[model samples]
Target: MFSTALQSLSSHLPGCASSGGTSLKANLKHITVTLATWDAVWEVYLDPKWARQQLRLYGAQDRAMEQFFKKLKKEISELSMKRHGRAKQRVLFVGAAGIGTRGDWGGDAVLWACCK
Candidate 1:
């Protein structure tokens, strides 16, 4: 199930200049699977576009990076599962208004909570 979601997200990710870039795809798959376990789905919810962007920006096509992502996913999944129940969890981000501060924080915060 998690793999399927990762694949779906990989396909949806933008800026794939290379057709043979399965490395990024694989990394994304691993991350999503890990997140599924960890309950970090909130991160994705918080900045879905940013998450996708990271995948693209990293452009990792090496085994080392793949392993790193896989390990991270595993750790995150474990931690998230331990902290949060198996059921989906939600997170909310509230911000205060200030002169030099933009309201950008609330959008993703609200998105993350609502997504879960």
Candidate 2:
């Protein structure tokens, strides 16, 4: 199911060209998945576009990121049922004002160094 959602994202957002001569479609690292045991974890990568149009600094618009959130919820709910009870859960939908190519990191205090 998660794979299906990832596939759909590529369709929704046509990629932009990057300096490395690769398109954003080729850099699907935007979405990250990690595994944990005896606990529930669902991390949905928020599209940069969605954040810009629908999200505010201190709040979110109704259904701002609904589609992805719903899919993650459904998957987590199903997995929780198999354990027969509520579990320690961590659901993260992450985005930034401008982390990728949208803007240079100019406002934040955190120095973000990277590898070439």
Candidate 3:
């Protein structure tokens, strides 16, 4: 079984990415996390908030950025496992934007990345 967690960022952002991390821990805490995933791929939602935080640095077609996001999320999951001292096989990092609401290139990019 997979223990997935999904957390959305508050629409209330403060000063771009500066205070963006302010709500990170709180948001993460709400992700329904239990035992963290240790060896499985980390599938994180591509929220505009998160995408803007790091994804914006790469070009639209930059493949490296995709892997970068994957590695970053995986590391984060590892940290989560360390904190909990347990490991699962899967987890979900859902962003603020949910299904049928993605209306931007970032949305499409995530789909492509995930599906590919």
Candidate 4:
């Protein structure tokens, strides 16, 4: 039960943005579904206001970003059913971090050369 997440990552992945415009938000539905298949995944957003507005996760309409992600951790740890016949270790830790994705190259590495 997998689906392409093109729409869901509009906020996090920066695909739907055009010409200095904002992108659509679908992180909640996507992350929730993906969590069903994953024990843990890292989501690090530097901007709280932007991330909250973008990650329209279930029950997050009335909660702050901290509350939202804490609930997510809870769901992943206590709720989701593993899709296998055996037990698996699960753990996740979220923290503050920054990355520069505005250009094709940065951070001691060259990801791509969009312009030659």
Each model's TM-score, in the order given? 0.23, 0.25, 0.28, 0.20
Which model, 2 or 3, shows the larger lDDT?
A: 3
For model 4, residues 3-38, the per-residue Cα lDDT tens digits are: 346544444655655635432335456566787756
Deviation from native of the Cα of residue 64 in model 2, angstroms? 7.9
Better of 1 and 2 by lDDT: 1
Candidate 1 stretches with Cα past 4 Å from truth are 1-61, 87-116
Model 2 per-residue lDDT tens digits across residues 14-116:
6652236755444444443223321342222355765665446313422333444566666777788778676435444344434433333322311221100
Q: Flag regions of model 4 displaced more than 4 Å.
A: 1-63, 80-96, 99-116
Best by lDDT: 1
TM-score, structure 2 vs. true: 0.25
Candidate ranking (lDDT, best to worst): 1, 3, 2, 4
Encode model 3's per-residue lDDT on 1-116: one tens digit a residue.
11222222334443454654555566455543532542232334344576675655455445674676677567766987998876444433334434533343344455555434
Any idea what lDDT model 3 has? 0.50
Total clashes, candidate 4?
0
Global local distance difference test of model 1 = 0.55
As a TM-score, model 4 comes out at: 0.20
Off by over 4 Å in 2: 1-64, 93-116
